[model samples]
Target chain A: MESPSKTYQPTSTPFDVDAIRRDFPILERKVLGKPLVYLDNAATTQKPSAVIQSITDYYTQINSNVHRGVHHLSEEATNAYEGAREKVRQFLNAGSVEEIIFTKGTTGGINLVASAWGRKHLKAGDEVLVSGMEHHSNIVPWQMICSEKGAHLKVIPINQQGELDMDQYTSLLNERTRLVALVHISNALGSINPVRRMIEMAHRKDIPVLIDGAQAAPHLAIDVRDLDCDFYAFSGHKMYGPTGIGGLFVKKAWLEKMDPYQGGGEMIKSVTFEKTVYHDLPHRFEAGTPNIAGAIGLGAAIDYLRAIGYDSILAYESDLQAYASEKIGSIPGVRLIGTAHDKAGVVSFVVEQVHPLDLGTMLNAAGIAIRTGHHCAQPVMDFYRIPGTARASLGIYNTRAEIDHLAETTRETIKLLS
Target chain B: MNSTKVAENSIQAAQDSIIEDFELLEDWTEKYKYIIELGQVSPGLPEALKTPDIKIKGCQSNVWLHTELKDGKIVFSGDSDAMITKGLINLLINVLSDREPREILEGDLYFIDRIGMKQHLSPTRANGLASMIKQMKIYALAYKTKLENAN
Candidate 1:
C-alpha cells in the first residue's frame, strides 16, 4: 500500500526511447533488418526477459501438475501456481486469492459468467445492459445468454469522445435490468469509464455489475474492493504475461449463488454414482486442467510491473498518450477517434481515403506494429458510422521517439495513399 | 501478375482433365486468382450478420463468414461489405474448404506468400487474413480424421 513519491520522476528514463529499447530482446531483432517498433500493446504486450525467464524457471525447476498430488514436485508446482494466484490477488487488490478464478483469457471468463450466472439468475424479459464500446468478448456472451433466456440486451450510447452517455445509461436502468457489464477502458477508443460511479449507480437499482477489465489491467491499478463491482474480467497476455491465461473475480455472495461454470476434474469434492457435490467458490468455476505455466508467467508479469511501479507507469503512459494525441491531431486529413477527457493508452485514427488495412500494411513495412479495423468493438464502429480505425496502443516499454516515428510515418502514408 | 494468369490457365486446364488432377497445378498464382474469383462469388452479406457481435476485426472491409458442413466437404457462405474483399474471402473459402485434414492440419499457408498477396496486405489486413486462415484451417484440422477414412 506504499505510494511512490509524486516528484520522484526518474531522469534515467531515456528521452530517446530507442536507447532504452535494448531491454526488450524482440525489439533488438529487425523486421527485414529494420529495427522492430512494436505499438500494438492493446492487442497484446511483448514479454520482457524477466517474464520469459520466470516461465523457463518454472518449467526447468518445477514442472508438474498442480494442486492434486501430495508428492514433492506436485507440492512445489502447487505452491508456485497458487503463489501466482496470490500475486494476482495483490495486483488487483482483491480481498482473497479465492476471488480470482483463472480461465482461457477474457473471452472464457465472460462466457463462464453467461453460462453460469445468466442461466440461473436471468429469466425471460430481464434486461442486460452494455456499453457501445465493449469488445466482442463482452458483447457476444450477453447476446447468447439473452437469446437463450428470452432476456433483452440494451446498450449505452457513445458520444464523439467515445465516453458512454451516463444520462442515457441511467435512463435505461429500470427495475427489470438484471445486470450491467461494461468495459473499464475501451480497447478501440481510449475512453476510461467512470467505473466507481458506474458500479454505484447500478447497485442503487440492486443490479449486479461486471467490469471488463481487459484493457484497464495493463495500464491502470485495479482495486476491486474500491470499485465494488460484482464481477471483473481480464486477460494476462494484454498485460505482458503469457497467453491462454485470464481471471474472473466474482463477489463471494454472487459466486455462491451462481451454478458451476464447467464440471470436470478438480471441481468436484465428492462424486458418487448417484450424486456429485461441487467444490467451493472459485474452484467450482475453474474445471479440468488449467494453464499452469501461463498463470506462473502472469505472476512474473505482475512482479515486473510492481518493481517498476504502476503509478509511475500510468503517469509516463498518460503523458505519452497526450503528446501523441496533440501531435497526431495536427496532421491534415488524420481523424482521431475516442477523445475522452479521461482515457488510457489507445489512439485510434483514420487518414482520409486510405483504408486502415492499407495504412497498417505500409506502417508494418516501416517496422511499426499497429492494430487496424474495428478492434473487436463493432458496436463502437457502428455508433461512429465508420468501418474501423488504425490504432496505436502504448505499453510501459514504449517511447516518445516511437510515437514521433508513428506520426511521421502516418504523414508519409497519407501522402502516398492520397 | 502474368504468371498468375498462366497459373490460372493451367488450373483451368487441369480442371478440364479431371477433378483429381487439379492438384497438378504447381504454384500459388492460379490458386490466388481462383481465390479472388471465389471471393467474387461470395454472396452479398446478409444484413443480419453485420450485427455488432459477428464483425471480424482487422478486415478493411466488413466481412462475415458463417460455415455449415454438409456431407464430407465444409461449405462456407460469406459476404463482404466491399467488393474486392468479398473476392479476397471467396478466394480464401476455395483454398480452405474441400481440402484433406492432413493438408489443413499442416497449415502450409506459405501459398499466400507465393501468390504475392501477403506482401500487399497492410499489417492489420494481413493479420485478419492470417486469423481467417487459421480459423478455416482449424475447421479442417477438427474435421475428425474419421470423416476422410469413412469416405
Candidate 2:
C-alpha cells in the first residue's frame, strides 16, 4: 500500500449543503415539536426528496414484476429495476451488474452468504474470523452458521482504543481458516478496518473475505473492485434510500460456486416435474418479488450521493466528525469511545455520572436526536464493562452547528445531572 | 349514591379475599394480555423521582423509580422517556407498592411469576424488571432490618 503523501490534500467538496438539506423534506419537520436535529445516521439516514419521489414514481407509473412478464408495465418496471441495479453497480464501482445481488439489507446479505456459502464450504474444524467491534447482525449470523456447521468462530480482538489488532488477526489466519468476515467500519465505534490490508492478507492465505459495508457505504467511498473483497454487503437505507432494500456484491467466481439462498420463481431458468435449473449468477440469488420501489429509491439515493460527489461528502463528514470529537470530548466527565486513528463521522461517549438514557432524554428534550444503548454491539459493551454509550453519527447534510448544539446540550446535561 | 361507602366495602371484600402464606402459581398466560393492558393504564412517575440513581441500566430510554414507606404502605414514584416502559413501571409499582414491608422483604417475587409479565418483555426489559424488583426488595429488606433493630 502506498503511504498517503504528507503534502497531498484530498479534494474538497463544494455543495450548498442547506440546499441539500432542502432535498430531504423530513429535515424540514421537527420531532416532539422541536426542530429535529437527526444525528443517528449510523442507525438509518433520512431519504432525500429524489429518493422518495423515485419510490412514488415507480409505484405510480411502472409497477410490475421484473425479468419475466412481457407486458408494458413489466417492461417499464424491468428497465427501472435493472436500471437501479446499474446505479448500484456504479454506486459501489463494482465490475458488473451481474455481481450485484439485492437482499433485504446487510443482515439479509450476510445471512444469505452464511447459509448458502458458509454452510456448504465450512466443516467441523474450519474457522471464521471476525472483529470484536461487529454488530449483532455481523456476529450472530456467522456464529449461527459456525455452530450449525460445527465450525469454530474466531474474533480479532480490538486494542484499548477500539482499533483491530492487525497483528493478532494475521496470526489467527491459518490452514483451517475458511473465511474472514469483518465489518469495513464499526457501526458502534466508527472504527474503519483496514480492508485493503486485511483482504490482501486473507487472499494470500487463500481464504475468501466478506466485508460488511453497512456502516462504511453511508459515510465513505467504496469500490469493491479496488478493495478486491470477495463479498461486500451494504444497506440502501443507510445511504439515504428507503428501508427493506440493499445489495450484496459477490465475485462472479464465488457466486458460481455458492448455492441459492432461497428457491423461488425468478431464480429458476426452466422448471420441470423432475428437474429445475437455476438462473445465472445474480438472478439465481434474487428470488421472489423484489422491493421494486425500494430499488428505485436506492438508485435515486445513489444519484443524490453522486450529485453531491462522494469524495466531498466524505471530506465534509470527516471534518464535522473531528470537530465534534474535539468539542464534545473536551467536556468534563464525557469519555469518548472508539478512538481509532481512522474513524468515520461517529462520536460515542459516556458521562461519568449520567446514564446514556438520561443523556438521551435531555438531548431529546433539546430536540437533538442521538442513539443511546449498546447500538447492537453487546460484545463490545461487555468488553468495555459498560452497559452502553450515547452515539451521535453525522451524515452528508449534517453541519458543525449541529455538533455545537450536541456539545452544548451534553455539557448542560452534565451540569444539570451533577 | 353512597360511592365512598361502596368503595370501602369493596376494599374490605378484596382484603377478605387475600391468601394466607405465599402460594406458587401456574403459568399465567391467560392473564398476560391483561397485564400488558395494566401496563397501558399505568401512569408516569412523578417528575421529582427522575434521578440518576434509579435509572434502569441498558434500556434505550431513561427510567427512574423512587419508593417510600408510610403508614405501613409502600408508595412508588417513577418516570421514563419511553411511554410503554413508564406504563410498565406504573403497573409494577401498583402491584408491589402499598404492600406490607414484611411481604416485600420476604423476597417472594412469585406474584410477578404468577402474573407472568416477564413473558411479554424483551430480554432487556425482562432483565431490567428483574433488576428493579431486586433493588426494590433490597430496599424493603434494609428498611425491615432497621425497624427490627430499632424495636
**Candidate 2: tens digits of C-alpha lDDT, residues A47-151:** 877777777777777778888788877888888888889888988899999999999999999999998898789999899999899999988999999999899
What tens digits encode model 1's per-residue C-alpha lDDT throughout A270-369? 9999999998767878789788888988888887677667788888899999988987888999999989999898989988876675567557767789
Regions of model 1 farther than 4 Å from truth: A1-20, B1-151
Point to the candidate with the largest lDDT. Answer: 2
Q: For each prediction, how big is the interface RMSD?
A: 7.5, 13.7
Q: Which candidate leads the pack in TM-score?
A: 2
Q: Interface RMSD (Å) of model 2?
A: 13.7
Please give the distance, in angstroms, between residue A407's alpha carbon in candidate 2 and its true position after superposition: 1.0
Model 1 alpha-carbon miss at residue A274, Å: 0.5
Model 2's chain A TM-score stands at 0.96
Per-residue lDDT for A69 in model 1? 87
In candidate 2 chain A, what residue range of length 10 has the lowest lDDT sum?
Answer: A1-10
